[model samples]
Target chain A: MAEVKKMATRDAYGQALAELGEEHENLVVFEADLAAATKTGVFRKKFPERHFECGIAEGNMMAVAAGASTMGLVPFASSFAMFAAGRAFEQVRNSIGYPHMNVKIGATHGGISVGEDGASHQCCEDFALMRSIPGMVVLCPSDAVEARAAVRAAYEYVGPVYLRFGRLAIPVFHDEGMSFEIGKGETLAEGDDVAIIATGLMVYEALQAAEQLKAGGINARVINMCTIKPLDTELVLKAARECGKIVTAEEHSIIGGLGEAVCAAVAESGIPCKVKRVGVNDEFGHSGPAVPLLKQFGLSAENIAEKAKVLVK
Target chain B: MTYEENMDLQRKAVKVRMGIIEGTHAAKAGHPGGSLSAADMLTYLYFKELNVDPKDPKNPDRDRFVLSKGHTAPGLYAALALRGFFSWEDLKTLRQIGSHLQGHPNMNLTPGVDMSTGSLGQGVSAAAGMALAAKHMGNECRVYTLLGDGEIEEGQVWEAFMLAANYKLDNFVAIIDKNGLQIDGPTAEVMDSGDIAAKLRAFGFEVEEINGHDFDAIEAAFNKAKETKGKPFGIVMHTVKGLGVSYMENSVDWHGKAPNDAEYETAMNELNAKLAKLEAM
Candidate 1:
């Protein structure tokens, strides 16, 4: 097997922003003193004039981005997910979301992948919080290519967007030429018995789980759900109709993240599908190494494969 | 400013105050005290200061006014209505279902409103963002925001002030309506913002203090603000809560309530008398 390249989605976000800056003159970046960590510093290095350092004030940065959006500028306000979506949730809701402003929030280090930051820094509730806001587009990219594509898609789409990126360097699975669209789910593998729907860092894990399930004589369908809000109900319903037994995976809380969204879609369609959610089981994550913590929290391909195996049996 | 100019602004301010009373009374539940206190400055900005066209409200080069103290939407709505952004008759429908005049300033619904603000201490940051945008785009447009004295205690307001100063947004102006009273009681008792002008100066602003109702003083402060360079401008307008109405003045009870029919009648009578006096002058 060829050695897979590994890259953090936050790095892809920064590189995508710098490339977008060259294409869109009105593309400006705002960071709440996390330019280096959130990877907006890459864009700052390239387009110093368009970059705004808003100190450690995420609320003010969100409002500033909202204001800049009103003046025909596409402002990407970057910060850690804990601060961007958790601390400044009201600012994001009232200042940007309420007005339906064209502000893209680049929230990095989402979920327990933020190693050693402890429960305080790991933001597993960003998708739920951002999803609650009306007219907010919530996106979580699976790999580096998808992250870059999601950033460009956010810039092209009008209104507010919340793009969650992970801190850990994960496998870059998707090809650079792959098409990415907001509200569209990409199916990586075909199956008949069970379907594994996943988002963010867990998409790669779902693919690995699919291979494991294949060896165990259970053909598992793998779907990468990037857009959590305005969820691809069509694809979700189709998966439910075709594969009655479904397992949803994410590096987030199972309560209101991709799993709940998929469950809601399936339930609303009145489809009789048994769904299992493989995610952080409604608990805060303590300080630990990223891979070990993820495995311990049951956010691994083994867990997903186990869940799928149960449903298949 | 000339006596005639001051009288003209006074007349406009009285009309705006009447509009505030009308809107709040019609809603039966709205913040009238802050709206009345902010009426004079709202009038001055709409009538004399802002380089905005009522016919072309969305013009990119136009000066932007954000009611950072957005609970005083009645004052802003009245000023915008009188300036021909909408019908003054529509002011009666303030906060009603299907009304464009929301309880707070919503930029999308109201024509002259530049930013949506209701939650305290957030609007100033938006104004700062607008100022930064203007500086970046080289649009040569000024951004103005109004803040309540009590609103500054939110901590986010100071963050915005820091941003405005750090960016050297000379084209930005932050006006605080120091009405001395919030919903609780006097601002001194309810988290006093001690010496706002001095604080603004410390935050890298060219500070000016003035009687908010005094048109000449308001004019002079704005002129000074335009003249000052390399820093943002802050105007601490000392104002009385419910300035035009007789009974509501200095009363914290009137902070967020509508007047009864009899009290409304008395308020309208006093304002009408002031209008009659201004018209005669």
Candidate 2:
């Protein structure tokens, strides 16, 4: 058995940023006074001169990142998702997205797993808000390894990118050398009864659900759909055609996260399938322990298996 | 600065004003009052202060200019066209469909523009960022942004000021066109951002105040900005809402309204007469 590691996606983000900073000298980072929490402190330690402490101003930080891009610098602006996506959406839209600047917004503490911070800090609508901006690439990596790879991919791609990360330490499920491509999904398992599509931390639960389903004599396929915008439509349609039942699990709003994206893709492809969405349903999160919140919000492995069973029936 | 140099800048300012009038008149929907007020400063920067080439507009080392108060695109477009970044004929297409001259400054669409800015108080933030980038790269390229006095009412402007000062961005200059009038009324009535110079100074900028329309004062302020180091510079230029045209001068109604046929002709005639006088000098 492989020795699994436990790490927060933000930790992976910081590590990848430090590595990218070494490889690309033109890479710069901007933060809004949450460096230690957001884990940009790691990169700040390595490259103090390249890190800009924007001092609690996300709007200014966003526009500043846009400005740096004009000077040929790939700037990664980091902050909590609530501030980055909610408070500074206009700046991100007009300054970076409209001009199609080469700026990567590394937003951490996304979704309800930011436990104990309550509704003000949790950002479940970021995927939806960012997806609406034209020329913006929205990525939500499922694990530590994938988060690190997503950072590198965003750096290579020349345009506006929003990379969402979480605060809680999730399991590092995948191997280090697994392939990662923007706008592409990776099928982690194959089955015939149903397909379980997931993004961000929910991929782990979806895999667990697949495992539990196997014991019940119902096989389920698990897939990691990282890129929400520019989604991998061909793979999603294939899953719909093959399995005929799709269940999407995410730590975001059911309105516009992986579920809506998968549903839209399936509907646009003229394929009919039974779709089940498992996430925060048009509601805000309350202060609670991370594990309990997952169960309370129906985002746990057990709940996912139950949903799969109902769909399989 | 030499008298000849000042006179040359004066002539260029007149041409820029003419272009602004022509641009707004042709569009039939643009802000001429603020554009005319900002003509001299834009003219001085484009003609003398900025180290930019029309041939290589995207040269990384060139000094960057951001029109933070972007509704005044006519002023920026005129300066760019006169500086040979584009054809002067295209200046008439301001706000027209398919024209590179958008209602606001778009860096992608316009050749000489360094940052895309339309929403108030945002361009200064971007300009400060550019200055920070230049400082990090150990480059000497400077960044300059023009902001409206009324636009200072936005809280984001103060955030940008704080960021600029905190970063110790010496390679940055912010010019405030204190036109005293917004679309609604006098800025004092709308939202009194009391004492613009003092507010910026409190924010840690090495501040200067000058008459925006005076060529000599404009030259001195920019030169002083260049000499000062270790802090960002702010030049609060006292300016009328509309400088060149008689009817539009200090008029709130003219803030964003384009001239009708009769008024357009009168504004053009006035600007041309000023141009003739400067050309004769």
Candidate 3:
């Protein structure tokens, strides 16, 4: 059996994309001067011609990728989340989302965990912008295991997809051979007292929180909600109905993040439940270490456990 | 087929233009002025030059066409309808709620629409993607896109243009409809696009200036485009805003205003005579 190694989801994305490209020759990749940074350099080393370095021009890179998809070749465009979502938003919206191209934007360096590089590089609003785009599928992978699965899943799926990753290395949550399906949520733990829903780097923290709650004799169910756009409403509703209380966590802003998505789903179902959100408040991040930044933004395992305790009570 | 066989295509162009004017007039809301300006180019491509199958709109091997100036979708809808991609009757449904014919081109809803475009700078970028695909696949199929002169002001269009040239997208032909007018006023008065031909040449294109309505000139430009070994080709077609009718030609007021019953009657009268001559010959 392959031992689980802690890795940045961006590394998983790079590894998985290379594997998929070799398996299906139709898969192509373009890096916006972040090949080594995003770790997509792995794919570049294998298929040099297929990998295009657009030289720091994120907008141009996005447009090129969009053009590539129209020719029936699936292009995975990798860049930082802030630039991909902010710099080339109109291109992503008009060319890919509007036309519904099969272009996957694999954005690394998302959320506040883009620590040390500080606030300017961190993108806490990628989900809000991407989820707002019509016909765009948004995926926030929790760990390397899920991130590898997400890249493969996004390639198989059609239309526009934004696969967001972060800078910090996180422990692998799923088994080595676990399967990932787009738009579906995975239930990590089963309980009836409270359900913990989370995505991206926070999902690992969320799982730890569930364990902490269990130690205190309170049952907590954890769900890894990877796809934010199609948003596994069935899974969310089941949590709201069965557990009757919910705690949502993510390394994103409270507004329009995984928390908001779960809220909208729970509200629309008219199934009343005590719901709490653990996320970054309306404040910018400062220079710090990874764990401290997570704690400061209230996206830590301790924060999730506290929120789960409140919601369950 | 010879030139005489392709002459029937001219008739199709007139019918397509008629569809454009009528649809704009019917909706009482569309840019008929620009749509009429690009009628001949659309007709030639859909009828003669481009190898496209209406039945297999998404076939990987088919040539890709993009209307970068998406405001003039009426022109494309008319051409696609005549090419049997959809029904000519569908022209009546333009801009209506639930109609596939949106104000701008939408690839999802409408058949034969290669990319959805409405924002001024977007479609060209999408075409860039299509051409890039042709390069990767080692496919000989070409990519043809049309842009409005007014739309060239958008920064992204230039960004996309540079990519096409930098990549030496020899398989791409970007046709610019220099119709001299746009919404609100004449394009010169609004935002001067100085010397489109020389500008495009500087941007690394095999630039050609032509009378947009001249079929011979259009064909010649396309041939020149085909002959060029490297670098993308750009044709700057000098055209009138409201091209076909006497009253509407070159008039900015007619840019989007649908003709009323009286004006519609006059347009039909002029178009009928033209259609009659085209059908007769």
TM-score of 3: 0.94
Report the Cα lDDT for residue B114, model 2.
Answer: 89
lDDT by residue (A23-88, candidate 2, tens digit) is: 999999999999999999999999998999999889999999899888889999999999999899
- What TM-score against the true fold does each predicted structure earn? 0.99, 0.98, 0.94
Q: Which stretches of candidate 1 lie over 4 Å from their true place?
A: none
lDDT of 3 by residue, A1-313 (tens): 5865689999998899889978988899988788998888999999988887666777767877887887778899999999999788988888788778899999999999889988888888889989999999999999898898899889999889999998888888688878889989999888889999999988888888888998999888889999998999999999999999999998888988889999998998999887899888877787888878888888899998998777766
Q: Which stretches of candidate 2 lie over 4 Å from their true place?
A: A1-3
Clashes of each: 0, 0, 3
Residue A47 of model 1 has an lDDT of 98
Point to the candidate with the largest TM-score. Answer: 1
Per-residue lDDT tens digits for candidate 3, residues B1-281, read 46675578777878888898788888888888888999999999998789899999888788989899998999999999999999999998999999999999998899999888888877787787788779878998999999999999887778777878888999999999999888868788899989889888888999999998878888889999999977999999999878777788989888878888788788878888987997777
lDDT of 1 at B215: 82
TM-score, A chain, model 1:
0.99
DockQ of each: 0.89, 0.86, 0.59
- Higher-DockQ candidate among 1 and 2? 1
The models' CA-based lDDT, in order, is 0.94, 0.93, 0.87
Ranking by TM-score: 1, 2, 3
lDDT of 1 by residue, B192-255 (tens): 7899999999999999999998888888999998998999999999999988998889889999
